[model samples]
Target chain A: MEPIIKVENFTFYYPDSQVPALAGINLTVQAGEFLGLTGPTGAGKTTLALALNGIIPNFQGGRMGGRVMVAGLDTAKTPCARLAGVIGSVFQDPEAQLVAEVVEDELAFGLENLAVPREEMRQRIGAALEMVGIASLRHRSLRELSGGQKQKVAIAAAVALRPRVLVLDEPTSELDPRGTLEIVALLQRLNRDYGITILLIEQKISVLAPRVPRLVCLNKGRIVADASPRQILAQEKLTTELGLEVPPVTALFRMLRRAGVYHGDLPLEVDEGQRELGRLLGSRASRA
Target chain B: MPGKSFLHKLNPLTKVVWSLAVITLAFVYQEPLPILSLWASVLAVALIGKVLREILPAIRGLIIFAAIFFLFQVFLIDEGQVVFTLVPGTGIGRITDVGLKACTMLALRMLAMTSTIPVLLATTPPKDMIVAFVEKLKVPYVYALMLVTSLRFIPTLQEELSLVIQAQRAWAYDLEGRNIIKRFLALIPLALPLLLMSVQRARTMAISMETRAFGAGPRTSLHTSTFQLLDIGVISSCLLLTAVLAVVSLR
Candidate 1:
């Protein structure tokens, strides 16, 4: 099967900046895959996200090399508006992204821009709100919403366009832990049930490692690591060198293995770690 | 939220028209009677709308500004017969009857005419103001959205600016204890970072707008702004009264 997104030797430099924001980067995302992207600040995560939807070379003018293709269309050639149907981008700051006053109006904004028929727009808005679990907030003012609700509304606004892929750039950076969980869970649901390809840039390793099967790590505008979350977290030296925190569960497992107490592969999630620990102790007790 | 007073029931555009009527009528005649009467009518609307309390704060500031303007006109202009000379010898000594009359007319017109703004603001939310711009003023929907977004960012930018100022103060930058020029000069450090942040915000918002297909096709709003019968009545009466008053003043 063809990948939903493909970036080949992609290198980009901002205007008047010496260092390239993204340098010789190669990446691929399959349809319906949940890919987590993480790196320190100014690590080119946002630049890469913008490139996926053609905002880089199209909307934001910069020196660029190589190509990025989304949904069979080259991002360099396609205008950001045309790519809107193929890629829905949820930005970091929910407040900055919201242009409407009311929740329902925010949802309708994208569909209206896409010129969907009035009847169709209403259905899509309803479906998007229901899917985001914010149907009751449809008529409420955006000002009165909690941070999580506002982010949900932002997600609804993007999803209303029914894009093929969703790109979120640090969506939960401004949200609380519970709000972060709601968004992560929402992304999981979108990936699992709707089969929408999700590219999430998140810093919360514990939250991201458990959910996203694949994690891509960027460093200094380069894709230094691309593997399963388990594999990525197991490389203690690489993760530390790149300034990424391994999930606490994964770190504990690694420490146990290093101390010669446990002999098993590193688990990226808490439940998996718990199971591993239980089995290790049970076997040890049996031998004793 | 505005109370369900008769004025509140009128569309925001009707209120805007009423404001324009007051401003125009205030400038149309040199006499203070018409302007004061117009100002009283606006006050009555504010009172009935239960927004008098909200509007008073803005009116208070306007009164101070008007007072300073009145003083300038009465002392500086020297357009009519001399009335009083408190200072006796210098260029700023004389006060004239015509200057006093002009100052009173100008200040009262300014005070009364400008007071309508506070009334409108007290009665209309920013969202309704954008709605009025979109539906009544025929501004493009995207531009209307920009207006709303800008209004939303004002408080956010203010907060961010304060943080920036505080951060600078922590670095031992003397932002206080300065003359007017020096204080403004001290703000340069604040302004640079603020401008950069504002630009960043604008850029992010623009990118977000594009990703969501902001201008991809014909747009439709969830809440359609339609004028009520009350809006129509208010608008017509306001225009008729203004026109009649204009003709009378001209005569």
Candidate 2:
């Protein structure tokens, strides 16, 4: 199948800046795939995400090299408005992203801008609210909602566009743990049930490891590691050197392996770690 | 502030037209009684809209302004019989009947013209107002959105201001000191950060709006505003009342 997103030798420099924000990047994302992009601060995660939606060079007015294509449209050439329907982009701040007074209006904003028929816009708004599990908040004011609810409204607003791909740039950074979990779960469902491709960018790997099959690590505007979460997390030295936070469970299993007590793969989640420890102790007891 | 009253149900454009008519009539009437009646009629409409109680504070503020204005105008005019003298034998603050009447008319006209605003605001939600402006008045959607969005951010900006003040206080920056000059200077620190944050927020908001295809093409609104029979009736009545009042006051 043709890739849904392709970035080739892409480099970007903000106007009047000496250093490039993104440098010599090459990546491709297949349709219906769930991928996570992680790196330390200034690792160009947001720059790359913006590039994917054509906001980097087109909207931000920066020097660019190479190309980014989404849904067969070149990012540099296509207008962000046209790309909006193909790739829904959610930003970090929930308060800033919402441009409507009410939850339903926020969802309808994109659809209305795209000039969708009123009836279809209503249906999409209703479906988006239901998909985000905020149907009860349909008529509620955006000011009355909590940060998490506001973020959900933002996501639903993007989701209402019915884009083939969703690219979120540190969406849960300003949210609480429960809010983060809710957003992650909602993304998973959207990717699984609706077959929507998702590219979630974050600073922490723990939240994305168990959920996303593919993980892309960035450092200094370059793709340092692109592999399965297990393959990436197992390289503790590489992750630590790059200033990425390895999952605590993965770190713990790595410690045991170094001490010569365990020889199995690192666990990315707590439950998996618990079962692995149980098996390790059971074997020890049986041997004694 | 959303209500199920008749005024609330009227199309926003109709109410805007009604308010404009009342303001026009307020200016046309020269007699205190006619101007006072115009002001009374605005109050009566507010009462019918069930927003009289909600608009009391705004009306109270307007009353205070009008009272001060009346005092100033009363002292400035020297025609007609003297009602009283503030400083006897010296005409520094003479109170004349003509001055009283003219001031009363002026104050009443000012009150009647300005009071329609709060009533109109109280009855119509900003969203519906924007829809009416775009759908009925042929105003560009982008300009309407800009107006509504700024209104929406007022509370947010206010909250951020308080937060900035608190943050400054945490760092030993006193904004409530007894020294007036020091207090005024303290606002410099407050204003700079708020301005910077607002600029950053505006940039983010622009990007967010663009990402959602805000200016992509000719847009459609989900909420449609049409002139109902009640709107037509109210508009016609407003025009007729203004015409009658204009002729009577002129005569």
Which candidate achieves the best DockQ against the true structure? 2
> What lDDT tens digits, residue by residue, belong to model 1 across residues B35-153?
77878888888898888987888989999999999887787776878888987776666888888888899999989888998888767767777767887689887677777778788
**Which portions of model 1 show Cα errors greater than 4 Å?**
B79-81, B88-92, B141-143, B248-251
List model 1 lDDT by residue over A166-207, tens digit each.
Answer: 999999999999999999999899888899999999998988
Q: What is the TM-score of each candidate against the true structure?
A: 0.93, 0.96
Model 1 CA lDDT for position B213: 79
Considering the two chains of model 2, state its CAPRI-style docking category.
Answer: high
Per residue, candidate 2 scores C-alpha lDDT tens digits across A38-121 of 988998999998898878777899888998999999988898899899999888988888999989899999999999999999
Q: What lDDT does candidate 1 reach at residue A129?
A: 89
C-alpha lDDT of all candidate models, in order: 0.87, 0.91
RMSD of each: 2.4, 1.7
**Interface RMS for model 2:** 0.7
**Number of the top-ranking candidate, with lDDT as the measure:** 2
